[model samples]
Target: MNYSVKNILLATSFQHKISVSIFYPENSSNKSIIISSATGVLQKYYSRFASHFSSLGFTVYTFDYYGIGASNSKSIKHITANLNAWAFDQAAVIKYAKETNPEHKIILITHSIGGQLMGLNAEIKLVDSIITIASQTGYWKYFKGFSRFRMFMFWYVLIPFTTPIFGYFPAKKLGLFENIPKQVAYQWRQWGIHPNYMFGHFKNTELYFSTVSCPVLILSFPRDLFASKASVDWLASKLTHAKVDRRHLIPADLNIKDVQHFGYFKKEYQDSLWKLTETWINENS
Candidate 1:
């Protein structure tokens, strides 16, 4: 069950450098997993989860997007990287994982916005399977009650107002997540404002989603205020060519209070939720 972690800098096609960590298991399996972090979440947030998977014999890769975490080379204001740039960065990581372990089957594990990036990549076919945790379209209409109004303000009011003034989205200062490049914040705002999310924003999104043929398991929690069941289902339905299994988890059913937006990655869920994740990966692999 021993494993070692090594950090490396990955140069993307856009010339942006990504900070990546590869976990090597003492007894490696034929399956390798690349975990894509949610927006503003650091690669380090998944280190323990990646290590746990490595101990189970899977080589795991984790990385930060171009303007986030260890990949940030300069001030966020100076960074013009958008969603496409982040997707390209992820594509580079996938290519590196494929080249580094050519014999292994690659599984992509994504959180929130991380799951949405795969459809944007032409190299998604290289992934054998995908597991998306709370990944959903961010269109505010999908939410209900107070959550919808809050998200509406987030997209329409907060983002547009603050991004221009600060030259970046100061999410860290507001205690939301990490600070984000203004371009990313703007593009994300447009997507959230649209009814169909990214699919409505771009012309080629249907083709992008149709290209993915791998089996996908999408996990959503009822307690997650950010990703509603409707939003998750909207995303799941868009994966036209993939065999998608979307599960809506009720926290109380599992004898837990909640597994909100970021709780799934917490080490406390190792025995319950993590076990389910490992079993799914094995079955899908």
Candidate 2:
């Protein structure tokens, strides 16, 4: 099957324009998928994954959150946004997908923080199912050993010290994936410091998590230090009404070297790890 990609700008209710790319399959299915990116990761990073789904007849939508990637209309320092703000952007994307393809069942594929932000969207009902990849609470205690110590330094030392001087988090400068808005960096730090992560920092947000009743497929890799099994469980436990399916991907069992937090979306895993996502979506849909 053939597929075509079109890049367009989507407007959020907050007056920010998000950069979105829609992949349309030549043979369209009755389903449409929205790929929500992890924090500081660009939408382009998921192009291979989206294209694969598009080739399989699922119309896929991938977008960059405000203040990141093509959506960055101004300097990072001037772009003020936090997790909740990004949630509104995600909600808008969901609304767009539903409105544009009324006949299609909506599927949400979230990576890392993308899954947590889904809880903040009031338009949760728009989604028919969800696939969370390494999405977990940011509470530092969820990790153990060196990973736990790393989280402490990330929250207390690196983020706090760098964000102020640069007016934003220069993740790329520090050899991280991408740069981040100052507020988003600060918000992440605050959540990491809290025992309950985002919910502990913002008490009312917990109600939103409970409202997601759609079937959810949670995928966590054993080697992903950032999203340990315990961390993933913390987030899953909050989905009080959702039918949650948890799967731990052990690289050794799959005859692979590694599939850490970000490796799941890498092109190399298209036949291995990605198959799990495709199978889950088909089963749930």
Candidate 2 residue pairs that clash = none
Tell me the deviation in Å of residue 238 in model 2: 0.6
RMSD of every prediction: 1.1, 1.2
TM-scores of the candidates are 0.97, 0.97
lDDT of 2 by residue, 1-285 (tens): 499999999999878899999999999988999999998999999999999989999999999999999999999999988877899889999999999988999999999999999878888798999999999988888999888988888999999998999999999998877899999999988989999788876666544788888899998988687899999999999899999998887898998878888998888888888787888888997
Model 2 collision count: 0
Report model 2's TM-score to 2 decimal places: 0.97
Please state the error at residue 57 of candidate 1 in Å.
0.6
Q: In model 2, where is the ten-residue run with the lowest total lDDT?
A: 200-209
Query: Candidate 2: lDDT of 44?
Result: 94
Ten contiguous residues minimizing lDDT sum, candidate 1: 200-209
Model 2 RMSD in angstroms? 1.2
